[model samples]
Target: MDVIVETRYGKVLGREEEGVRTFLGIPYARAPQGERRFLPPEPVEPWTGVLDARAYGPICPQVANPLNPVDGFAQSEDCLRLCVYAPAEGTGHPVMVWIHGGAYVFGSGQSPWYDGRAFARDGVVLVTLNYRLGPLGFLHLAHLGGEAYASSGNAGILDQIAALTFVRDTIEAFGGDPNRVTVAGESAGAWSVGTLLVTEAARGLFQQAILQSGIPFQYRTPESAEWFTAQLLDALGLSPSSWRRLFDVPAADLVSAAARIPARDGLNLRPVLDGVTLTQSFWDALRDGHAAHVPTLAGSNREELMLWVARESEWRALSDEERIARVDRMWGPLTDRARDYYVDGRTGDELLTWLVRFASMRTFTYPTIRAAEIQSEYAPVYLYRFDYRPSRLGAAHALEIPFVFGTYAHPSARALIGERPTHADVSDAMHAAWVAFVRSGSPQAPNLPEWPTYDPKRRSTLIFDEAPRVEDDPDSAERELWSDMTSLSM
Candidate 1:
């Protein structure tokens, strides 16, 4: 079965699968190639004939990795596309728009693990989109000014706003309600949602947002971002006189140049604090009740830092004194608290995993707490802590994606989580909670524990463990430790 819908960019034929109709590689904007590399996305021209959107689009150009086996895939610059999945017999179902995460440097909406079929099964329309990344998506060239470069260092986020506007203007033709939309994401995507929540440009586009493993703390200052952009040009052998040379350089060269650029001391290449598109930090806006009306769902996993700590063989070579010293430096004054909870008296590999987990919790816990505090004033906020450990990796980063999407048979799913049913029920509960939230503002579901909205009084949280339960203020000890340290609210 097929459904042909007329979009502003002309007609598109969507293919029907078993239970859902899917449209893939639908262009929301014109390709940002050549002269338009660092510029804002342009409106896609209307096509006279029907566009066959049966296949997934190409992923954005990214740096390839040798040690990390998964990064070895075909990538390109012509990747500003979107994929949509909705019920075949749809009328007015709620919608969920997903944004993938890879530290704002890599990741695409085209990954098989992000398949929205399960979301459609859960009675929601799911849309995943791809936008520019790396230098093309986030560089702040000092010369470009005006609305053409108004978004500048934050082109990736502007691309998202454009995609949401497209959805707001056109999704009704596909049998989904525009007003009942929920935007959700993990890691950098979660941070992007945080950014969207505070922006005046994103007003009324989404009713609810889910931030998984991230909050407002993950941002770079504008001055720093501009400095990094200048360094990139210098490394490419282009004089300041030839700043415009970046526009003509081959896309492959730009992507390759990204690989050679060293990590900014300790900073990641991400959405920067350009004063135009993003005037104030997300924390500033959330603190001043800017996002008071927006409902939010925020949380971090139990073993969130295992992957970052164990990505390479760096930990193996460190001596005991050096290792423990490194841990102390990472945790600083919080080392005592982390040692008390995670390490206790553990040593060697056990201690390493414990410290990694503590570090991740330290980084994310405060931000999530702050976000909850600010948003709870106007709307219900759902808070959670994923503590389900699947084998040695524990409950590492991105472990919850497949579970929430209910794609147990995906190849990457099997790779990330081994064949185990120990945590399957937890996934079912979480996915159900997500679907219920989209259906209405409340996340209450039948047969599940009564999930409470976050409040300063109870500091209530949904504890997702072997036996899922609602706990009153699970992170009180840690929250108290960071009270004085919290300079910003969200």
Candidate 2:
């Protein structure tokens, strides 16, 4: 059935399946092309007639990775669009906005893994959105563009804010409650959720947050951003003085140039501390209780780094001595303590797997713990750790996404989680908890036990495995070793 709803911009024709009404490719903001490129997102221009929002919009421009491919999606500069899924009968359902993760480079709202039909079936309105990516989104070019591009570095984040604003003003027409919105995501998207908590521009945009497999602190300073921008210009054959020519450079050329810049070059083109759009450090803001006082659910997967390690052939073949040197270089003075905790008696593949697990703790798990600790000071924070090991790969990064979205049966999911029978029980428990959090501030659901809130003393964390259980200070020994380390590395 075709359903037509009148939005602020104009009438949008959506399609209905079962009891869910889906409206895809709705322009939340104006097309970010030509003059609007790299600038703060502008409000969508009012339309004349009903807009056919049946198909997914073009995804943000990025270099495609064949290894981790996003199948059957168009890409273009006019990619600042969002999708909405709501129950056909509900008038005031809670809204859950999802920001897809792709290391701030790839991924989009159109990813099949992020389908919102399941959420609609559960009586929640699900909204998925796309923001600028890569150099076009996060490049720090304010030093060259000056006043016209002060918020250039954070253009992607600003796009999210704009989408939320549109939802606030217009989602009520789509059977959603503007005042009852929860923002959620995994990895880079989760990082955005954390960043939004402390962002003044996103002050009243959401009522709660859910961060999965993400770090709350990962922003480059202005000095570092300037250095990265200089290198990027060099890669594009533009000198510092000719930096303004970047606006004229083709988007494809810019993306290619960005992809060529090595990771070791210190050219991190992620979010930046621009001293404007992002005024303060996210960590400092959270610690000082400057973040939103809304309830939060933050967690990461066990063996989170194994996914990356599984892709690296050279790292898998490293000698014991080489592994020790790599660990020392990465962990600094904590190498001995970490080795004793993780790789003391292991050898070969077992040793490498343990090393990857330790790296996961340092990079993803510990940072999430710190975030929960800081957030608990101001509001109720629930912490969790996903331990449901798949067939080949363990509970690695992004492994919990399908379970949370109730899309475990998806073909894409089968690649990550083998062809074995899907874990329907775990999916029900996890998805219910997510829906519970969106509707009410707590993640407590009937499918799971009474989950307690997190605190510094107990550090109660829910471990999601075949038999899920709550454990207080799980992995306490390893966590204690990093207690003195004030900051977490990305």
What is the C-alpha local distance difference test score of candidate 1?
0.78
Q: Compared with the true structure, what per-residue lDDT tens digits does model 2 show for residues 323-360?
A: 76775556333465666777789888888877877778
| Candidate 1 per-residue C-alpha lDDT over 1-490 given as tens digits, one digit per residue, 9 for 90 to 100 | 7778887678889988798989998888878887787888887777899999987767788775632233444566777888999888767889889998887777888777788888887789999999888888988764544466756688899889888988887788777888988998998889888888888888899988888988757577767776787778888888767878888887778877876776653344787777777888777777777677677888888778775566657887886556767766654434455557666687788778767756776667667887788789877798988888765667777888877887755777777677777657877888887888888877777746888899988988887776778999886776775664543334
Clashing pairs in 2: none
Name the runs in model 1 displaced over 4 angstroms.
66-74, 143-147, 324-347, 486-490
Q: lDDT of model 2 at residue 328?
A: 53
User: How well does candidate 1 match the true structure in TM-score terms?
Assistant: 0.93
Stretches of candidate 2 exceeding 4 Å from the true structure? 265-267, 324-334, 343-345, 486-490
| lDDT, residue 294, model 1 | 72
Q: Give per-model TM-scores.
A: 0.93, 0.96
The total of clashing pairs for model 1 equals 0
